[model samples]
Target: MKPKTSALTIAAIAIVLSYLLILAIQQYPTIYRRHVDPNSETEKLPYQTYLATFLLFTFDELVKGNFTGTILKLKELNQTYVPTSLKYIFERFRQLLNELTLKLDDTDSQLDYAEHLIYSGREDDAINPLKVAGYNLAESNITYSQLKSSAEEFTKSFMLPRTQFFQKIDSIQNLIENMYIRLQALLERIEFQKNLEETYLEIQVYPENVWVGSTITVEGKLYTRTQPLTQKNVILYFDGQKISETRTSSNGLFNYTIKVPYTYKPKANIIAKYLPVEDDSNKYKPTTSNTVQISLLYITPKVEAKVLGKPLPGKHFTLEGKVYAERILPYNQIKVSWLTSSITTQLENGTFKLTLKVPETISDGKYILKAEAPPSKIFAPTSTTLYVNVQRIPINLTL
Candidate 1:
């Protein structure tokens, strides 16, 4: 029985020792891996693998035009220690990114310059900038293709499948092609505009001197180098303000009669302009006629006076009259004078009324009463006279 027990105990001890040996064998690899030097060649494989993966992610981000994300990733990658074997690859990527960034900036600047030229009405000058932009985009596209090929080769070296980065490149290429097509179309349009004929406008104003509120004739003709432009619209400007619009007749002549606006200036400027519209906008360039100036005359108010009845001495009497003119007088008062007696009264709606009294000491007689409108900036002074008879109050005497 003791031999049997000893043999069993030896078998149990052998089983425990074998289990401990297997456990130690498994733990030895973990402990060794944990203690491996991070900078050693053995650890370089995983580090390079991580770098390659991160580079692919950054490449994809750049292809997607995620500049902000690409920059952040590039910063992180820069901080990482690159192995000597991959330094040239990183340098190439850095150079490619820098070139692409510069190309993009150049393209943006050219586009801005072209837009500014267009807004400044220099479409002819804008074409060069647009062409430069297109060239820059084309160069960028070539650079992008090179970058894509390099990335594809790097991806394949890692035995990785083609990613959406390739698809993004295709999209960017398509966009660039579309931009080129649009630029070509714009250039064609500019060339067409450059070929369009210039327009000439001739105008004459009748009655060089006119009163305010009076009509004056504005006649003009629109023509090109070869022939007149009939049925075209012509606009007339009075003192820099648009006053009337007319269409050219069969002879390419337009006539517009516009009333002179009431103004305090001594003279006004008249101009005729022809602006192309609809199909004409593509056919002809806009033009303006010579500036014509005309003298502005003020209207003289005609004054007429009448007494309501024979006025008794020392009694009030009504003197009323209508003031006629080409325009209403801005002034509100009219002056009346009668043999050393004078009064100023209000005028309403081109007419005036006044209350006057004859001196009691004056003997009864016939006298001339006058009504006058004082001269103003926009009204000429005028006066009219009326024969007025004055008498004393009748006296009844008791004897």
Candidate 2:
């Protein structure tokens, strides 16, 4: 009775251990599924390491004479394990590739055995399995070499280069996309600014009525949105010709003096215009001032001089002249010059008279006298010449 009790107790312990092992096996799939975190690097655990651990655990249980526990451990491995790396999958594929010839031989042996059984008069048993075996052998005729060549060609043509190029293109696509976005924005802004034009310019000329061959002052200011525009070029045009150019000062002031050509038209058109400099931001377009009209005129004068009652040398006489223009008015302070001496006189009623003394060196012969009136502010130059005869004085002496 004592030995039997001890044996039953030992049997009870063994049953408990077997139950615990089965329970652990049932829980493994849940445990593995829950513990694998796809986001974590540790989830890339090497499959070989997992397989070795399972094998070592099974070996330990087998060494302890736990056959049931080992069997349960192997089942858990079969159910819950999955290979992750393409390297491992490709290795297993090669291994299966090596087994193809053995499978074909096995099919051939089955067909031969079926033929033998048919000859032995077991036709019913041979017919079904033989048909299946023959069908499988026909389909599996594709050789290992052919499969390997196809896989290598696919890798060379499609898989390897596609993978490398896709990775490199992923890096460059971000920069290209950013540049495209910025350029699109700039183009949109430029399109909106194509139809705007604005500017402010004012021009003036001193003495709007002018004469030919006379100087006139050109003054102007350039403004943009009520602000002074400095260092800008301004040009003056007269009768459709460029006459003078100047740059604006710090205060946006520009001035030029131009002499009206003598050949200008009766009415002259003058303009002051501004041109934007290169490399400058021309937010406002080039601008021009309003046109200014000026009237042109010419003034010319003439004069004549004569010596009256010049009969003897070293004698006093009268020299007279008249200065007149096309429309004779009171000509005041007309200049009269002769030889190295000059005198100023007024045209009294379009005529002028003055006293003159002939030089004592005169010698009873023909002589010439010239008088000139130089150009003045409003009149051109004029001159005249006169000829006269002088006689030597007779002298008496007593001894």
Candidate 3:
């Protein structure tokens, strides 16, 4: 009876330790979701295996109370200790992601992103591939003419969901769950350091000017700051005097109306302030916002209209709109030429720098456009015509 009991106990212990050892081994150097071959995004973390190893390492170091083995074993696999430290940082990572999940509520289209957050591991940063692909394609050196067709081909070259975005999240979650015990343990250590000193990134505001009692949007980078910025404290002001204080969340951005006080209307200044980190001693020292001058004499000017792209048979000609208003009137704004034969529609801010594709709607043949602002408006009007030769080839927008 004693021998039988001893054999059973040994078998159970072996099974548990074997699982633990495997988990620890899997995340040795760095786990990756995609293979480490050429012609792909390799920096993307290996979510599932990394999480499994993380959980295993954490349990060994904390719950099992074995630190030396965790350190030594991890060190043998790689020279870096970031992976081992992840064991302690997993919970914080989880919390940050949970907050990210809440951001889905801000937009009706991010329910799947929320789900990805539910089971997301620290290494699983590829939650939104379409966004990733879009950003990548946009940032590429390719021109707008080349982007409308060939750009989409590189979408799958990167991780994240191309179409079934939510499904990608589900897939990532399920893959990690396959080894749930390891994944949970792996999330023990996840730390992020936002070194704001001399950030390589930049944030600049246009017009750098504002007016009292005017609708001045603090436009720059709504998501310019780093992570953990959501829920951070904020303070807005003019000429060093505190005007308003607000908290940022979801988007880590701010764009609100500031009722310019009548007390200081003489060339008022707009400034934004925020506490990026409160836990540290230097956190109370709020970062001053990019300054902008609020003047009462600025007038928005009119824009020139023009046709965009080569019109094809059975395709509508796209028109690009530009508002070249140098001196905009105080409290006066500009609008898009939606009712006219404009190819490019300009944004309200007059920074009309958008590249749009025309759809197949207009009939084949020559099309004319009166692209101009009338005398009543600040802009002078103009007209042009586009000739489409559909007799040669079929309509192919991709071309």
Candidate 4:
């Protein structure tokens, strides 16, 4: 019985040692992994794996009675040691937060621009900023109601009424400017009417058909609304040049004699101006009378006639001459006459040409050939005579 018991005990002890050896072998890899780097990617495991690892670590701390050390280790693993995937997620979240912050900064800048414009009395210019602000607010992740409410409060409290006030100021300024212009125009019109009603002047020059270098008498009268304007200065202008000046008499009539100057014009523009006497009262303004145009007749025109294309007896000859006046005159109505007979001829550029036939029955002697032109209303009558000698034909072959 002792040998059997010894054999059983030996078997039991052998079984026990073998099991312990197997168990020790199995725990070798786990203990080796636990001593590895703490910050390794495998250390950042899934939630369940981390919980098991944490419980194991906590159990070890309790066995060693390191309560504070276990708490610190747990905290370090949970909070400080972060996995690469979770770090990437946190980095992406930081980037989004930074992007949102930048967008908010942009919105704030736009709001600042709008606020500055509104404060500077440029409400009309704030529309673009406000629109951008609204768009950014819609795009933002923040609540729209607060920002929009603040902007609305600002508009209602200040911007609207301030804009209206500035518009009213501009309207008032424009109104004042228009009123000033209208008042100036009214004063001018009143002055014009007053001048028209208060002062009056009339002029008449005698010998309207006077020739150049002749004397002319200019008579005029000046009168007010009720009485004659006596002793007031009256001046006459011919062709925009001052010619004569005289004072009015008690009858308000004035006269001046002036010699006409040489001119090439067929008409004369005469104007009479009245200058009121200077007085302390600024009631009367200087006045100018109406223009009186007069006909200026020229002196007698000179005529020169010559026979052209040979002046043979009993032959046709051209009589051409130029009729010129002392001044420029219409030569279209000039009439030319030769002796008792008259031939009508058209003048070209103050020149006339006519064909004449010498009488064959006339004796061969010095005969008078005359060219006379009648008055052209502006020019006096003129005549030119030329004597031509005709030779008698020695061979008389007549029936």
**C-alpha lDDT score of every prediction, in listed order:** 0.75, 0.60, 0.41, 0.60
Winner of 1 and 4 under TM-score:
1
TM-score of 3: 0.22
After aligning candidate 2 to the native by TM-score, how far in Å is the CA of 342 from where it should be? Answer: 2.1
Candidate 2 lDDT, tens digit per residue, 180-250?
A: 34334433433432432445568888788888888999888888776888888887888878898988899
Better of 1 and 3 by TM-score: 1
Best by lDDT: 1
Model 3 lDDT, full chain set:
0.41
Which model scores highest in TM-score?
1
Q: After superposition, which runs of candidate 1 have C-alpha atoms over 4 Å from their true positions?
A: 1-35, 43-81, 157-161, 197-281, 284-399
Cα deviation of 249, candidate 3, in Å: 2.6
| Cα TM-score per model | 0.39, 0.29, 0.22, 0.30
Q: How many residue pairs clash in each candidate?
A: 0, 0, 36, 0
Cα lDDT tens digits, model 3, 268-299, are 66666553454731332234456676664333
Show the colliding residue pairs in model 1: none
Query: RMSD per prediction, one decimal?
Result: 27.4, 48.0, 24.2, 41.8
List where candidate 2 sits over 4 angstroms from the true fold. 1-231, 234-296, 328-330, 363-368, 374-377, 388-399
